[model samples]
Target: MRVQDTLKARQASIRKVVETAFKKENPPEASEIISSPHLEPLQIRDYFAGKRWWDITFQGLFDDYIGDSSACLTFMAPAGVEYYLPAYLLMAVEHYYDGGIITEDLAYRLKRSIMREDLYRMSLYSVEKKKAIVEVLVFLLKEYGDEEALEAMRAVAMHWGSDYIKAGGQELG
Candidate 1:
């Protein structure tokens, strides 16, 4: 099938999965309504997706429930809905990296957004969160980093090389 078709199919599946998971975690009351947390992050093929996803998940949670709404809406919101999408996006990036669908110059452009600007900061409130954020960043850099960025990445790799090696991944010479 075409790429768009694949994306649409994936998106539909994501919508279903997200909805189901939402219901399971927060089981809808007899009388309730739920808004869709933005899934734009999963849509972006590059850094844009990461930025969008983080923005929507955090802002949506903060906005819809924090100050204005009643306790019902606040409790009704799908709290952990944002978690799974990041992993899905990261896995997609991993596939792209393993197949070399990226480059250094592209990596530089990508980082600005991956780090998140004009949107929420790239964070998940813990080391696991930071690691997830960084995993996407590193996956992109490995695939597209230009010499300058690659040099920067190399510096990081050098620092982390031992860790990487210990993880059974190759070290960059």
Candidate 2:
């Protein structure tokens, strides 16, 4: 396949997996949306208010507050993270080759969230959700060769075992 075709395939896979995995998740209540300490909480809440993950367009975001929407991920509840994660994944795939800061920030935040040591955050995900995340991480690693994705994959392997990593068709030694 051509590189474009391969990228398209990866994008399709990411969209299908994420949408399938998170389709039934409810959007976090506006009040539940949290921002990083330096960011205004109300602005973050207002931006996400009444928006479903699927409904949020990447272009429509990241313009007002920061250069990218990754800020939206910081300090959120696990449920909020679950609700909004698909958007970030989709955005990252869409912008993978733009050489833009958006994809970089998205990838960075994604790795941090996955490797987070907070048991409260880690405990909320189901096995299926975790597997889906591994799948997405594998896609990012394979498609973009992102170092962040590789580190996140290792973290997932450490936390969930190498079997989950293997399921994504990648082996970590």
Candidate 3:
């Protein structure tokens, strides 16, 4: 297979695992999740999109999916993207995606696997936190089982890297 095709296969395989895990575990119900004080009315409505109440509850679902499960989307550095990105970085990616806007440089950082940067500033875009975001999402995704909910989560998660989390809970600027 061509190099590009080979890469695509790997990405697809990753998403499959995430999706399966979500279907089996099924995170907390939508009502409980939407009620989170962290999200405002607008965010809740947008998340629900008038579909099902128990949808897109696990913010972590998105994180894990792209953490390494998907290629089209990621928060971690691939083989040569930036030397290397850790598994926890996936959680950080979800955090930034949920709370902040990702930047161009940060996105590039996720694409590469050699330009390893600081983890503390990942959320602020200072060091690029896609890794953590993806990690968190993966952890959460493993808790959900509803297909609709998983898809909704993916919608938000499909746009991050898998290399944004700091190791050992280090402080960030």
Candidate 4:
């Protein structure tokens, strides 16, 4: 398939996961985050409050908080991470080239999250969510060849290989 078609399919897959796994989820409250004083959790909360994850367009995130979408991923509660991750993944997919450091930051953060075993914990992500994440990681690995994506997938294969395989992910080196 064409790249455009692939992107559209990935978008549709992500949307389906968002709809199924994250339906009716609320954004993180200021108190739920552990941001530095400068980052200001309240501002982050205010930006996301009253909005579903799907409602948050990538272009409109964190204009005041350092102009980086990755900041939103940092210090977020697991629930908040669950809510906001799809937007990040979508941004990484759609804006991979023009997005500058944002895409790399997304990959790095995701790598860190997976390395910490936070994202792969069964308590945090359901099987369906894990499957969706694997698909996204596969796309990042195959399409972008991002080092962080490779590291993240390696972590998954090392620690959560069973789950990864069950999620329909191929083995990684």
TM-score per model over all chains: 0.28, 0.84, 0.28, 0.76
Residues 1-173 of candidate 2: C-alpha lDDT, one tens digit per residue: 59889778878877888778778566777666654444555566667876888877666774555433656677565666778877777777777666256566665676677667582276367777777787877777777788788888887777777888888888765
Tens-place lDDT digits, model 1, residues 8-32: 5644554443334322232223222
Go through the candidates in order and give the clash count of each: 6, 0, 57, 0
- Which lDDT tens digits does candidate 4 get at residues 40-129? 555666676666677665566634444345576665666667777777776777667766666656777776776765542333577666
> Global CA lDDT of candidate 4, please?
0.65
| Model 1: ten consecutive residues of lowest lDDT | 68-77
Clashing pairs in 4: none
Largest lDDT belongs to which candidate? Answer: 2
Ranking by lDDT: 2, 4, 1, 3
On TM-score, the candidate that comes out on top is 2
- Badly placed stretches (over 4 Å) of model 2 are 35-39, 64-68
lDDT of each: 0.34, 0.70, 0.31, 0.65
Which scores greater on TM-score, model 1 or model 2? 2
Please give me the total number of clashing residue pairs in predicted model 3: 57
Clash count for candidate 2 is: 0
- Per-residue lDDT of model 3, residues 1-173, tens digit only: 69658645644544443333222233333443333344243343233323331232234334532322222113321221121122223222233334222321233334232233242122233232333334333333343222222332332233322222222122122
Off by over 4 Å in 1: 1-85, 97-118, 144-173
Which should have the higher TM-score, number 3 or number 4?
4
> By TM-score, highest first, what's the ranking?
2, 4, 1, 3
